[model samples]
Target: MSFTQKFYTADHHFGHALMLSETACARPFASTKEMDECLIDCWNSVVRKDDLVFHLGDFSMGLGDAARVESVFRRLNGRKRLVLGNHDYAKANVIHPTLAGLAWDAPPAAAMETIDEGERVYLSHYAARTWPGQHKGSFHFFGHSHGRLAPFGRSRDVGVDCPDTGYAPRTFKQLVSGMDLEPIVAEEAESFAP
Candidate 1:
């Protein structure tokens, strides 16, 4: 495989018991085990081993054991790169830095620019009103809101909890094709209205 395809997702929160609780994001899983299994299955089904996957942040939480965390990472498919989330600790980095590929701990709301499908994109754990290259047609992908927030301008939530994403990693083509940016534009315009 040429590994040309790329996917993006975030807020898996693996091993976090709260994720399955009614108080937290209201994830559909009945237990942590079910959530973990379903997330892994969904990821593996869509992402090949040779494909690139950008995990925006919050990969796992509540699994204090290093070995357990690493175990979960081992089962996920694709070439994983991480933009560290609030839940990702230093222990995670020490346990499997190489496995995470180009990992970095980005401060909340910081923007990292990259090109996808010949267009610029700003990757962050939180969405922003505007980012670098926004005037030049750059789009933003973020997690952390868990789909609680609406998309703004060219930005959209890529979190697993997003209703449209269905807890799976989404490709650039899927994003472009599936997202209706008209609503976002209207929302932005509404925000600026008096």
Candidate 2:
């Protein structure tokens, strides 16, 4: 099947050493270095320089220096866009400034809407139980849960930590093709049953 140029992912937590600890995010990496390297490799492997990437939120953690964070962001492929996460603030400035310096586009809101393949897609850092156009076949994508929450209705977690996505950014085609929406649709229908 043909795919859209847009790819989605979030919660990279780059430079965050806790992500590699067994007691923290419980990532399988033995060290933060390994985790960062692997994530960068996985990202560049699928995303091209020309591709557009929608990173829902939490791109990095523990890297407080804007210059260092900017450096890391520059190394990643694709035209980047961000929906700021809670961890994104450092010192007195938002991370968007650094990203903007590198040509990354940061939408002002925590949530935004876009059209893809004739479908409305809601992008947010946190998942919502009921979103605009939820009953109109619109899709909602979010991060922040890190794969802990189950997807409902037409919503899906786009976090890199989401097991279903193999810790990499996924294209629109891949997400739709891989999703089995029957259960979710049936549940929604049941909710409306008298």
Candidate 3:
């Protein structure tokens, strides 16, 4: 609930007109421009300039070029990092594992591990079956499913497009509050299918 801590978010798909279409995210906006502006405002309203933000991916699309992407980041609040998503690639299926390490505080990684609030954390644009130390209480945060994916064990999706997040950047505690985090084998994970 506090805005002073680190935050996670993704699937902004800024400038991607299709993001608001019914077949896509079905965002409540008349145009992509309106959606983009609203998302930025929501992000800044919660995230402070010094807060760390992990953007799980699809940060930009349909913006046309790197400069536009860079410009968008400029208007955004917080010191940001990226976990590259599928649509975040340059030419080939390239937004995985690692990036050229430019613009961002570090390279845009497909996945990576870090420490958060004294707990181990795994970050990715896609969900993982069993992250390192999950049974030991580590948390895996991801995006790209746009809220369709089911959370397993301690994993969660931080995408803003997800109705749960309400287009705002949320702290890890805020993201997982009230959820069952007890250790469970990945084999017992819930399925989206009936």
Candidate 4:
């Protein structure tokens, strides 16, 4: 019996035609329909009702525009998952009738079982200084180098890089014990990978 789930990984580069907040979207839209309705009203105003949003990837940029960003992520609420990045390979044949769920970059033991069980740790858009020295246990949240959230002067880590707009979304025990983040088990996730 262990029901503790409040994970969030950001990088909602939604449709991405361009113009993503150069001082809050300075006239740069060839499409993406106003950054997909302001990232679906800023991730449904900080995502609550059934929280569990793990993006950590581009989500869209092609593939017939991913059916208008999978119809606004199927009217967002929660329970979404996708680690497929690199512009989501033009959506790879869009499909997301059930909220959201996608996984790619196989072979890290098949992407570590597509994460479940209250998620002790596993996230990726990329950040591999060898992935904490070749897979260990839990804790590995990542996002393409928009990085900036230091605190690993010596050891144990719970990596960071979550921001899409004015960072707010939280949970995962307030993001790993409220910002004291230090959980990388096993090979110490390769000294916090990247």
lDDT tens digits, residues 107-158, model 3? 6777878787787889998998777887678899999899998787688888
* Ranked candidates (lDDT, high to low): 3, 2, 1, 4
| All candidates: TM-score | 0.81, 0.84, 0.86, 0.28
Q: lDDT per residue, candidate 2, 74-176, as tens digits?
A: 8898878888777765544555455445567554456788887777888998998777877667888999988888877678888887876888899877777
- For residues 1-194, what per-residue lDDT tens digits would candidate 4 score against the true structure? 23434445555566665535554334344456765676567667777556666666655554454456567667766666666556555245443322233322231111222354444454666655444422434455555554454423111222222332343345455554444344445565555557
Who wins the lDDT comparison?
3
Candidate 3 ranges beyond 4 A from true positions: 1-4, 93-102, 185-194
Model 1 earns a TM-score of 0.81
How many clashes (backbone N, Cα, C below 3 Å) per candidate? Answer: 0, 0, 0, 6
Cα RMSD for predicted model 1: 4.6
Per-prediction RMSD in angstroms?
A: 4.6, 3.8, 4.2, 15.7
- Model 4: ten consecutive residues of lowest lDDT: 104-113
* lDDT for 91 (candidate 1): 66
Clash count in backbone of candidate 4: 6
User: Which of the two candidates, 3 or 4, achieves a greater TM-score against the reference?
Assistant: 3
Using TM-score as the measure, the top candidate is 3
Candidate 1 structure quality by residue, lDDT tens digits, 22-76? 7878888788889999999999999887787888888887555666677788888
